[model samples]
Target: MNKFEIFTNELLKWNKTHKLTNYNEDEIKKQIEDSLYPLEKIKDSKTAIDIGTGAGFPGLILAIAMPNTKWYLVEPLKKRYSFLNYIKTILNLKNVEVIRDRVEKANLPKVDLITSRAVMKTNDILKIIKPFLKKDSTILLYKGSNVLDELQDIDASIISRGNRNYLFIKGEKWAK
Candidate 1:
């Protein structure tokens, strides 16, 4: 099996004990695909952070896909952090760091890219990460079909790419 397959199986097995994700095999596959949809847009970033990285979705998968870019997986819960750390070890991932703290409490450095999924609303995310975002940094939010509605009052632009809707918001400080 490929690295992703191995990761999936291992995640599922660990989930049995830890309940990392509620997704089944098919759902996991779909989530992985969705997580990777923004890869090209963020491929050139030197550093990236995944906030609330439950089960290491985009962070771990992105780390596996992009070995050169450094990744920080920020997860608040202890159990999820342990699982992410274990996955990082088993995958022999040298470019990923599993952080066991909430984003607000963690002293994270500015990053070229920030990603989150099912974590919070657009405005709230922008507010929470405002301190960690640079002027040219990009924020990629994974949202469902109601993305348009979610971004209705937001000032940022929306870009549709790769079978997924990504809310692309950029600024040093967004009007939240």
Candidate 2:
């Protein structure tokens, strides 16, 4: 089977014991598609951090798709954290790093990109990831129909497909 298939099977197996996600087999498959949908629209990042990476939505999937990009998948929940680590090992994702902590708590370097799927509001996310932002950094937020409402005054561009809104925001972190 393919790597995606292997990853899904492992996720479903772990979910039985860890209850990592409410998604069924089909939903998981759809989610994998959802995770990869941004590749065609965005440029690649040299380094990235995925916040609240539960069951490895866009983060792990993106890491798999962009193997050259260094990916740090930060998940706070114990079960989810363990599951992420397990998948990283089984998949032999050399560019992926699974962190067992909240995004705010984890000690990480500034990255060229930040990605979060079904996480939080656009503004709040910027606040949380402020320290990790560089002038050329970009953020990709995977959202739904409420994306426009959530964008508010944020100067972010959107690319919509089906129910998903890929919010692309440029980060500007000037040095002190």
Q: lDDT of all the models against the reference?
A: 0.83, 0.87
Question: For residues 11-121, what per-residue lDDT tens digits would candidate 2 score against the true structure?
Answer: 899888888888888999999999998886554689999999999998998888898999999999888888888889988999999998889889999999999988788
How big is the positional error of residue 160 in model 1, measured in Å on the Cα after superposition? 4.2
User: What TM-scores do the predictions have?
Assistant: 0.91, 0.95
> How would you encode candidate 1's per-residue C-alpha lDDT over 1-176 as one tens digit per residue?
88789888988998899898898889889888888887887899888899989987778888888899889999999999998898889889999999898898888888888988878877788888887788888888877667776776666766675556777777555522
Query: What's the C-alpha lDDT at position 125 in model 2?
Result: 82
Q: In candidate 1, which residue pairs get closer than 3 Å at backbone N, Cα or C atoms, i.e. clash? A: none
**How well does candidate 1 score on lDDT at residue 84?**
87
Distance from true location, Cα of 75 in model 2, Å: 0.2
